[model samples]
Target: MRPSTDIDPAIPLRARDGDVEAFAELVEFFHVRCLRYARYMLGEEEDAEEAVQDTFVRVYDHLGQFRPDARFEPWLFRILANRCRTVRERRRRRESLVTTGELPAVAAEAEGMSQDLLEEVEAALEELPAEQREAFLLRHVEDLSYEDMAVITGVRLSALRMRVKRACDTLRIRLKEER
Candidate 1:
């Protein structure tokens, strides 16, 4: 679940230069990770898929604006995060009063955990405040550095660290309560 370190440095440059094949390669490389992030954020498969599609479309359209000196992964994630927020806002507006008790299933399975423990973890994650959840996921799940997270989320570094710390504290308390 770490941020990919093997991304080709030339791919973003080629993509910016309007190389369709290069863009396709970027999509192929990033799609799964993007989908995973979107799903984790949005908590629904359909919404995640839509958000990722919209993210790619926006990426293609705005490729010209990408700065050559900047890292592409953070820039791409920024767009995807924005797309997820937009989708979430739209869903909130559309369904103002949803009352479902069913929790959104976690997409990733823990290798050595029992099903009950996994459920507890997923529920604990779901209970986090949205900002905390995003910060925690970007830091622990995606394994991005605080600087990279700040770049992607536009939050100050100290604030991001506080959010992540709060998230971890909340998760620990919640998981212990579950046990």
Candidate 2:
């Protein structure tokens, strides 16, 4: 299940003040969603977990750097997204040096569907360019606004919108072909 995206104002305030409990609360709150996004972006459980863990550590270390006026969710996601990108880059580098027989795992768990359809959808998602996939997942799955996505991804609003549009179009065509 996806975690609620709501940010409690007090949590960040307390966390920034070096309250360990508050930081733990923040981790508990954002962990699921971060893991979900990382898993989809990296396509491996171990990589996803590592990314999420790294994200939290960075978040804690940089808590004092957070702007009080800025919304916390976007800032948190921005960090998580960067971690995912780094992990992806590392995996790419490693793959070049050594060929592996591992397959990309499903980004999200699924149920009550034909296994073939699930696999097909996962394959389609994997085929998308990284930017498109991130755009699609952030906009559709995470339900973030274009402005928030721009802040998190550092992409211009127009470019992010175009990426989401292209991602949706691609997914529709690919899934339709599979039918």
Candidate 3:
């Protein structure tokens, strides 16, 4: 489902114009959602935090490059997604040095969610390829439109639709087996 944020487009514009409070406002506005998305993308709290931190830093550094007429969410997500990829790559290289069986912690625990169900779902998610998981989270979790996802991911609309469909089908089957 879509997030509840009713963003004011001019905030980023103000930040682009070197307004310090506006920059902080931008960070405050998107921080939670960005953290959640980053957690899903990176699969760890620390990595997600780093990705979000790096994203805001990059956004702050390149505010002048932001297009005044553009939608801020997609642009911001584009940066965050790239940061996630970078962080994930680094983790892969590090994992080659050490091994662990621990699963990444959930970003946030929903009330009334059973531990068994959360574990099953997390295990299922970890099974999917990164592209499929990314597509699924972007489409279903973030509720971004295909056009926005296209911009954020640099993937074609048809391919994204296919990815989401595949992800849904896979999750449906995997979760069903748990019942």
Candidate 4:
């Protein structure tokens, strides 16, 4: 059965029931959005792309268990976030193992292209802790509400609010320092 919001309700239900065509339709609908979220969270383009693909696989495996009443995007996002966390943990382990090495460089053109406003915002966002960064990106960049963020991050609404607030404060401080 298609979710009510979907243009074609039958497709999702069919997909949920193991129809390949219906599943493919769902993939086409959500793929780009998932990739954008992955990119914003992971920061590495290649890693982000991998994360998106991983998310799709997980979603496919678990889709049969999804509640019909629940919204689809949050379920997908939870998978994405879990994948991102795994990638980040692996990176941390590698970082601890490595000796000193040249850090990844931002392209000169990227830096030159950014105005002060953009630079300050980007710098401040980079300063946030991972959870807070995810909260901020979901809330502002992706335009998700606090409730949706709570679902996506598997946090309570109050905790999501706090994370977003902390992210904002950190951004403000970093931006002020840049001025």
Predictions in order: lDDT = 0.82, 0.85, 0.84, 0.73
Which window of 10 residues has the lowest lDDT sum in candidate 1? 95-104
Q: How far is candidate 1 from the true structure (C-alpha RMSD, Å)?
A: 3.8
lDDT of 3 by residue, 49-70 (tens): 8999999999999999998889
lDDT by residue for model 1 over 1-179, one digit each (tens)?
55475377789889999999999999998898788788777877788889999999999999999887878888889999899889888886543222233543453344666678876776778778778988998888777889999988999999999999999999999888888
- lDDT (0-100) at residue 83 of candidate 3? 96
lDDT of 4: 0.73
Work out the TM-score per prediction.
Answer: 0.86, 0.86, 0.86, 0.76
lDDT of 4 by residue, 1-179 (tens): 32333225566667778988878888898777677677656666677778988888888888788777777767777888889988877765432221122323364347664455664565566557889989988887667777777887889999898988999888878877777
Native-to-model Cα distance after best TM-score fit, residue 128 in candidate 4, in Å: 0.8
| Model 4 alpha-carbon drift over 4 Å, by segment | 1-11, 93-116
lDDT of model 1 at residue 76? 86
Every model's Cα RMSD, please?
Answer: 3.8, 4.2, 3.7, 6.3
Residue 7 lDDT in candidate 2 = 80
On residues 34-121, what C-alpha lDDT tens digit does candidate 2 reach at each position? 9878888888778888999999999999999987788888898999999999999988653321212454345334455676777777
Q: Which prediction has the highest lDDT against the true structure?
A: 2
Q: Model 4, residue 40: what's the lDDT? A: 59
Per-candidate clashes, comma-separated: 0, 0, 0, 2
At residue 27, candidate 2 shows an lDDT of: 92
